[model samples]
Target: MKLSSSAYLRAAVSLCSLLAWTAGAHAESVERAPDAPNAAAPDAAETAEVSGDIIVTAQRRDEKLQSVPIAISALTSDTLSGRGVVTLSSISQVAPSLNVKSYPASGDTLSLNMRGQGIADSGQITKDGGVGLYIDGFYIARPQGVLFDVGDPERVEVLRGPQGTLYGRNTTGGAINIITKKPSGEFGGRVSATYGSRDFVRGTASIDLPAIGNIAVRGTIAYTDKPGWVKNQGGNNRYHDFGQLAGRVAARWTPSADVTVDYAYARGRVTTTPAYFVNPSFVGSLPGYVATRDQTWTALPLPESESNFVDHQLTGQFDVSDFLTIRSLSAYRGSTSHQFVNYSVALTAPTFPVGLTGQEDYRSKQYSQEFQLIGEIGDRFSYTGGLFYARETGRHDKLQDQFLIPFNRHVISTRWVEAKSTSYAAYLQGTITPPVLDDRMKLTLGARYTSDKRSATRNSLVNGNPVEVNARNSQSFENFSPAATLAMQWTPNILTYVKVSKGYKAGGSSEAAPVFANTFNPEKITSYEAGLKSQFFDNAVTFNVTAFHNVFNDLQIDFVTDPANPAVVSTINAGKAHVNGFEVDLTIKPSSNFSVRAAYSYLDPKVKQVLAPAGTIFDRLRNPASPFSVGDDVTRYFTLPFAPTNALSVSGDWTFLQFGENELSFHANYSYEDAVYTIATAGPAVRGRDLHASEPLERVDLRLTWATQLINDRRARLSFFANNVFDNRAAQFTIAGGSPLTGYVRQAAPYSEPRVLGIEANIEF
Candidate 1:
């Protein structure tokens, strides 16, 4: 599955040549529909061209996706539906250089990594992700609640490579922008229902009310319930089973031609069974290892977990003149989660009949406000300036109890953490098209100054007695991120750009067992990139390519000290790293009957140095288990976690029949990802057990649909889909636990879902 650099280049060249050949004879021009739901509808005269463009708001303005200087992947609602993308985790199949993993026990908890850059630990609330996630221009503060069902969105845009100056801090890798459908002035609604394997049932409804005077309103709701795929041999319970409900309401008012206001509210809830642990066969000689058949496992008990969140946002915009505008955005978001689990199955000695239980309660709240002024000077210069402020507060409370039934010995421990943070920033960006080279060359410059202050308090108790090894700490960080780009339009259909940018992520206190394990230094990255975007044969084909190199400094690494005390997690500042990669995206639409889309990514990442403090867990763990020596500077080379060496996706859609407004279509897609490591440092000696790298992933999805307006003046469609057609059981996560000295090394892994078949029906009126 490993591909060389030369192989990738050859593939790109071959694909481009094929596209040019297929589209060279076509002469039709296509007009794209606007991404904004409230934007003016397209004219009927421009609807039959067969080549449809996609509009994106990646640069804070509406433009064709092909015209954007940055490397971006944009998916519309119809595309998402066709691909059967239900959650954030499935986005990787369509987007290059993106990976997502979720804790099997809690579906709401997940991690998103792009180009080998992401948070090291999902359990730590203080840590921030390398990729920024935005919903309607509002940033999501935490990763736990990012996996919720998106319902239906107007479009989703994935911007790659250090969007620092515009996106602010914590976007060293990239950014994801989700834009939802706005309220329309017309009265309309849609309803959809789905049934699938594993007793899966899903229903969704959306309604738009006719405008009353200057106001319009819309509402949407979605619900899903399904049975778990993994069976529990010892009981009737199943792991990873869940039910979820989500709702959203939006309102828009245009009191005058020059001014407009918008408001939205959203809420979601999830309830699920905890994950089940499967003991590894390699450790079967140990007393704790329980042999199992297939992927089924024996569990003495099952745990329960729940999570919920609410979001509110308000926005206003005023058009002062034809070339000037002012906009403001305000938002608030809150979430709470609870989980109760039995840990003995995965962490305690089986022969001793140990019973270990733990409970966790977490809550978080965040508020943000932003204001911006956008102006255009003639046809030469365009600029935007913005100010932003955000505040966040959260608390985590956890309790653990251990019992030895044979010895009648019991122990209890509790830890509590409270944190608060405030952030401020001001940013400005401008693009200038000089009166040279027929005004085809442009220069862009941008900068942002950001300041962040954070404070936290940690408390602990042992067996009902207070422990003094806890304290309070505070820290502040400030940085200036700048960006520059030079772009040229060689022809009316070809554009090229080169960019250099800086990205920053603030440091914060850790919620570990020891009081002194409080904080880590900030992380930063400087990146350089060059790209080409082109359209050929009257816009029948589009091809884009990008090459980038990034230098990362002071990376934050999270590791566990002792599995016996599972809460003893620590964070350290690793010295430096380097990442270089190339990406290719292609789309071909020779005629109205067929289209093809393909993307590929190549990533090469290496850690340049490691600096672990003496007497720390990192230093102690590396003594004999890791490649590092005791006193030889302790530097080693390794790839970042979740970074696959190569990845690819190819999809096609064909419409074969059309009669009397009835059409039949077929879609199929294939995705492949090379093998990857799930942890920063993984080896057999480190955990006193043999460890295996993650298996390469391969998946194919297929869909068939029939559409018609034959149902009483309402549009109706029925579709059938099969995901993971080959049923590949690739592992997504791996963890090691238990005491190494006891000759007991327990390992747990969570695999991707098996094949799923479903049927869906949709109707619009």
Candidate 2:
């Protein structure tokens, strides 16, 4: 279900014109519902009413998803539950403009990329991600523990493109807003259990209490245990085994109709074995060797990676007057993790060759406070303004990596790193409708000013002596990001808008490469977009399309330096880059019993210039040490990390039968990702080939459910699910490497998960 960009655009324009001819003959389409992140309306019942509409908070205020003037994909509670989505990566298939993957060495860490902009090295403590992750208006500074299940949530909003005014910091790419269910004064609860292949088991429970003297509370708990499928020939350890337990408690109180307060405390822990890396064919085909590619068994033992986190949040809202409302959000969060990762293991050989391994123990804590004012000034004007502040500190001790932990170990390197940052910001946004064209056009303007201060110190000891380099200890920055949009209503069912925005990520020293830490600058982007939102055939069909172009300056890109020292990595600022893309999503609900959704994205990214310091490693054709280092412009060789040329997803839900207090339904989803290039390995090793690009991936998932009413009038359901139905396991990442002894070049490739089959049972009261 893919269409050419030009053809799609033309068809959309033609359809809008044809629909407008009869617009006056029909009443306005059903209310455009929203997906509000700040409001905890369980199941979206309190926010959206129309069958095809969604309530959303993209502008920090309740608005319809179609009316936000931004590209967004809302995953509602029903969708999440029906699809059995348990982790952050599970949403990437439905979010066309976004990409989520496990970090290089850790199985639970996350790497997010939106429209060609994201962090290449999330393992670096000081580096910030281009995309921001938020939980009920609270920002999570680190990626650890984000993959755990959170029971059932109200909705998750994925906003694509620069969101500088509302979400100020590190949003050059986009943002993800995760909103859990809020408490209702009525008593209700839910319980569920699931069992799957490979000994996978999960259980979850949640309860809500009746109101008592204007107070209400809710509690939730969940547990998951799954043994790894990849077996180890020796030792009990296995690759990808995972176990997690998480819980949360939330409360709300209201003394008067005008005042309300909410609080929540949550904690969670996840433990996992590192991913099993496969040896490339080149290295495995050598004299008297065995390749691990697509293998089910390994002689090398993999270690475990574990992370724990605690979070606290408080929010207060006040109605100052009939036209204005004030709100404040405060939060404190902390996390710690211990991981020993092996990128690639050359196993089952006559002589065991220990692969590259790294061990890290890290802890971080952050506190944030935000205040917002949302209201309309008059019949023609509306506004949203806010102020924000945050502080974060992190420490990494006993950080070192080389060959196997104990076997074939050579040079022992150890390091201790500590970093901290403080931030302040203020922002204002407003919308105005002039007395022209029958008030069908509106203009919106917004801006934010942010200031950040950072300090970092690295003390590395080789064998016993501290390293010689004295890294610069501190840095500060100030930024002003602005946004503007013009939206117009052509017909009751058609809306169009054009917008421009700016965003940036703060600069910090690379904790791994102290000498190059102060050598890079903050990365920034200016984005322009034009979009169309429309519904045809009396609200039965909906279509949304957006075309975007972004200009990037001082782009931060990471790469390994000196193959002999793979443990050391550096981040440098590439001078200029540009990304152009388009996104299209459609939904058709011909009847209440059946619905279908499809999304597609296309991207074309090019590197316009490469900075001198970054070019040496980014494109070796210009490096003095390379044999092909003299021919083409650096742009000819480099591509952004995790950005694919084309991505598409299609999903359908059908309720085919109903019999006396019983129901039956089916759900199916399919997604495809084009090949992507991320590794920045050099020229001679590349041999004029695009070895950096990984193979394309295809996924299919299906589910069937049966529901019935119990004798006591409670609702229950039973379901069976199958994921990766075809078992199309493709290598997600591949890289060239060398042993610490040098000249023994090797290759590393990691594949995706295999097929999974499971059954689940659930009940609600």
What TM-score, computed on C-alpha atoms, does each candidate reach? Answer: 0.88, 0.89
**Residue-level lDDT tens digits of model 2 in 367-387:** 999999999977899999999
RMSD per model, one decimal:
9.8, 10.8
Candidate 1, residues 176-286, lDDT tens digits: the string is 878887876655566677889987877677766656777888787766776677776575456677666678888888888788888999987766665554545435544
lDDT of each: 0.74, 0.75
In angstroms, give how far residue 536 of model 2 lies from its true place: 1.1
- Number of clashes found in candidate 1: 0
Off by over 4 Å in 1: 1-51, 147-151, 234-237, 282-296, 347-357, 402-410, 468-470, 562-567, 618-632, 683-692, 711-713, 737-746
Per-residue error for 174 in candidate 2, Å, reads 0.5
lDDT for 630 (candidate 1): 33
Where is model 2 more than 4 Å wrong at Cα? 1-52, 281-289, 293-298, 344-354, 401-409, 468-470, 514-517, 614-633, 680-689, 711-713, 738-746
Per-residue lDDT of 359 in model 1: 78
